[model samples]
Target: MKRYICFIALLAGMVACKKDTVRKGNDPYRETVVPAIYINKDGISPTRARVGEEVMISGKGFEKNKDKLAILFNGVKAAIISLTDTTVRVKVPAQAATGNVAAQVDQQYFFGPFFRVTGVFEMDTLYPSLVGANGAINNIIPVEDGKYLVVGDFTDYGNSGKKDKLNRVARINHDGTVDGTFGPDAKNGTNSTVASAVALPQSVNGYQYLVAGSFNNYEGVSYVNSVALLNNNGSLAANRIQSPNGKDITVSALKGGVSGSVNNMHVQPNDGKILLTGNFRFYVQPNFNLKTVGTDLDSVHLDSIQVNGLIRLMPDGGIDSTYNYDLAKHMGKEGANGFIYRSLLLPDGKLLIAGSFTKYNGQAVNRLARLNADGSLDASFMPGAGADQAIGNMERQPDGKIILTGSFNMYGGVKVPHIVRINENGTIDPGFNAGEGTDGFINNVGIMPGGQIILSGVFTQFNKLQRNNMIVLNADGSVHATYNSFGGFSAVGDNGANGNVNTVSRVIPQAGEKSLLVVGSFTKFDFRTANRIVRITYP
Candidate 1:
């Protein structure tokens, strides 16, 4: 009995010491020691990776004994693409929501303790294609259901004979199919009137209002020179407002007015006020209830430069009088000389406008400027980034950084073409360089929720290593190794007589899984389709 009691006490004390050792987090002895994970590679992971590429995970920690090693994905058995004594590689599952996907490795040690480990599987993509036309995409907004409304001067796709049937707006589906429900043979869910640029579209007044601007005069016949509203279905939209100033101009008569030419526009979400910008002397609102004379020449085509200012339309589609101002003087009279084509409403209730100009408000400013909603210029916002190139498109990253795309070769004295990210205050990000020996132009860019940036335009390679046209760079500015697959590329140039029109105009991401919208003049898509606008997905 004494011996039995002694043994029981001794065993209990040993168990207690082991438990205390682990719990105390201090004693090295009596604690289970895990073998440190290492790369059988004897070096760090390779930095350069092509899309859809995978990395090897061969190492001694787990592979030394299959009986002791096991790997799992999100706690489930991992779908191993490949593995060896020194490496293990896995494919990233698709449509994996914006979150972390963990790779865990558990290896039992011959000495005693187990080695449990984990890592991450990063996924992204890069799409490439032949170049197309040269133009800015204006007024891209989503419509009811799954339709998209895009208004621009791209009358034809791939030089094909596709007309802007109902003015210039076309309602298309996520799959790149035109919605026949919006126009005649072509349906635009906006106004039938032609505005150089139109607002996305909204349901207002007795009908849906699609605001449009003009460059010429309206003869009430075919030469329409004013802003017009069309119904929800691209029919001549009508707005019912008590012409605040007791005067109203019908949409058709805006051409001959004071601000006859409206080249760009912005709609206020707060009050549905329409801001029309163009090269005009002062803002003009139509008093169509009176016999109004149209544009200066009774035609939409005015050879001379017109006024450069802004006009405000009330929610009721009537002109707002009490709230009005001149954009020319506001944008710095001397600097607001060029046409304003791109405008974005910043987070701080200010407006940022970009165009072809070297100065703003008499001060040295590149092609971009910031304006208060009341037309006052924001001085603090200078050439935030891409100071070297002309910014073709800029999108605010989820991290509040700015991703600018344009044609400026020398960035920070280093040649990183196609894309560049700027810090919040507009400083060049050195850590996020796409690396050296790269060339091409980035036309458009937007970030998906997962922090992966999808960039499109024209480029043959990235990271001085990979080939991708529209590529999704990792959040760290590195090529997401598990991006799109590697494939052969065919170099294409304009075979047409008009050489300038043959380049990638832009690339638009759609709402479907691995779905994208590519707009360019290349009739041959991925060496397949002859259409200018195309939809591509993973096979």
Candidate 2:
């Protein structure tokens, strides 16, 4: 697929600035401003513009006279056609070119007066980087080719002798170290940038791509909800993008839905646009009264909040507003204390969102919810009417059934925990039922190619034996003993440098590969080699 990205920009007054410069070289002249993101519209499909058509895209950091802005057909630079206040007119070139369609810029600045820009570069394929420091490297994810992008939240501001203070992203070297590539001493301080990412690269439309999400700060608050990118190492590739005007955190949340805590992210079924789920809320109150109205609360200054139970993004850096119609919205128990922690997108395009909401779409639901393609509640498919437990991981199996794992004890009328099979209508599929599954919680779930189910979380007694933090379940929700500890991938290691990892957010299971990719907050897989990440394979 064609490689593309958005650019960093300002809005309204944010775009208003004053600068003076003396032109020297052939570089176009204009006022300089920092961009938040970069963009390229290649191979993305049904784009806002076509091959021969023309369109005007206005964004931050733009100048008409100084920046020699040009357009391209498929990356071919057009001739010096025309220019204006905020828009540039040029014929699309016929072929592909490595250089720019125009030079968008400023006359002078610390880096340079003007910056020449070009269309998005198409990347056919690229290997993804596996990034984790046990819990030592909080939110920094390693992108492909030795670049470290900051997921933010790292209290350690100075590292590699960089004391200028840093944001959340930076560039590192191939030796698992910081790269001094973009700036002189680029040290992104804590909270300056933030993102939640994994190391696995995915193939899309026959081309390879990277997936990431964030909780950026649009407001001056601690974490205002945002996400960005870098290659493989830590570096600034683009400006951060904010969520829809209000959405910050999701459906059901752990706590009462904080300001910016998007604990996890996901990908959509058909078009891999990227889905983010954590916890979102509309208002915050002190006492634990979800319906505390007309009780002096109206006069008090309350925090108006919005938790993003789920959201979709466009490749060209726009929010898929249409998705809000297809996904869950204004859901939860119709009070201040409702939210969504995680989700599972099914093969049939339906969504299974789990967290702590007691109602969905004005209907009575427990902690789990089933939504249609257009974001309305699935009234027929109901789960927790009696055994109301939270669903941590929901994955479909080969036999066309869903294996749900989480910290739940009862669902409907049966006793199930750690694992259960739910039919398409959200009822327990009696054909694949086991009395009571696990004695503890299952943070994540995956189906191995060999038909075994991999489970991870804070469990000590999985079947009858003593399991560490992970266990395997068979097709019928019983323990799969064959691959119990079959691989030495998770042994034991020193975790003094790492912190406590609470949840196993995701599990990547492939059919042919001998192992599966596991992710969580734990410092080690089990005890193996400081393994914040490890591949579980058979002997």
Candidate 3:
């Protein structure tokens, strides 16, 4: 009886051991629970967005690790703005065609409904028939009735159906068609004219334009050098512009003569007078040889009384002697021939100038200085220590503050990144700070309707974020966190490695539109082929 009992106990032990082994093999902790992803918990907020616009993506199990997840708009990769376990924000890739949104987390792939990606700005490919310029378009001004005045070194303008030989300056219709009535026929012996700057019409009827460049004549007959006033019909105006004592604005490379070209011009807001700045040393009036000058002129001469490079002109083209600011005395020696690059007339009649000079009126002023309406330095407005480098541009805000962009890393003894905002008193605003700012030089700054600022330059990053050549900033100086440039600006066929914009000369916001016109030397934008100029939709 004892042996039988022992055998029964052994059998029970073996059965119990087998049950324990099976339980261990099926341990709950050892079993893999594949992560599941769900999208649009609140339903996709927007089913459509333009390229470069941000779209909100909400879901679960997104994985805390951004590297473990991939987001795509259509087939192109969308740039992640921010990520969390339950939500993600990304910008629609500029290169993305219309396509669906997809997210890959770990080994699982989740797709949302199809989303439409639309273009933000349209290109001017058909009408103006750019064809491509032999030179570069240096500057452009928007005129009345949707026309644009373009200045550059090109010699031809037209479409595939028709071609017009445009000198350096030409007026184009909104569609890029050359305005035949605005100037003399291009083929009429005017082979080469290089206009560097143009000013808006000073007349209320918009019938006149002020042009400055390195040209000795117009229409192969009118002898005008460097400066000329044109009528709406492309003929010389009734009055000729000349130096105070009657000589030409002689600009040459030789010493003792005017040595630089006029780079910019601005018309006074209150008065029709004009303001000019460059590296030249004198200004001579054009000799029409008549008591009352008319459209037709006889001969122009460059030998006459010398004037400073910076000068204000009367409506009739005579130098405004009352508004005198000695450019030579105020602009101290700037190594390598530095000169004023830009100037702005303030609402209060003050003048702000920026350049590479180190002194203003013999006072230690870095790259920026302000002058009273009478051309005297404003002693009350002080910029301490000024900028560490050259200031490229300046824009005023409605609140009387100034926005500046340049290659500078410091301003007024404070570490102000490349872009900075200063109060009307010329003191840096503590509220405006761009941490580390841009990595390259900024050429232009444009303001949007709500005071949002758009910056364009050769920069690759802003505040340590990849912004490429263009970036948008909130009024408070914070990065437009959701703005993305994909790969920014680059030349076409650059193999995706070089995304730097070679140069961005201008950034102009379109009137009554949320788009911006970017003109520069770049041939591509956001990884797409865009010759010299492209319009981007700002979202």
Question: What TM-score would each prediction reach against the true structure?
Answer: 0.57, 0.52, 0.67
lDDT (0-100) at residue 419 of candidate 1? 59
Q: lDDT: which is higher, 2 or 3? A: 3
Query: What alpha-carbon RMSD in Å does predicted model 1 have with respect to the real structure?
Result: 22.7
Indicate whether candidate 1 or candidate 3 has the larger lDDT: 3
Candidate 3 Cα outliers beyond 4 Å, as residue runs? 1-134, 157-164, 175-180, 187-206, 221-223, 238-259, 287-300, 325-338, 485-487, 491-502
TM-score of 2: 0.52
TM-score for predicted model 1 compared with the true structure: 0.57
Order the candidates by TM-score, highest first. Answer: 3, 1, 2
Model 1: residue 458 alpha-carbon error in angstroms:
3.8
In lDDT terms, how accurate is model 3? 0.64
Winner of 1 and 3 under TM-score: 3
Among all windows of ten consecutive residues in candidate 2, which has the lowest summed lDDT?
A: 120-129
Candidate 1, residues 399-512, lDDT tens digits: the string is: 777776666665444566645776656557776766542356565566665677666556655555434355567777876644433221122445643221323444445555
**Candidate 3 vs. true structure, TM-score:** 0.67
Alpha carbon lDDT of each predicted model: 0.48, 0.45, 0.64
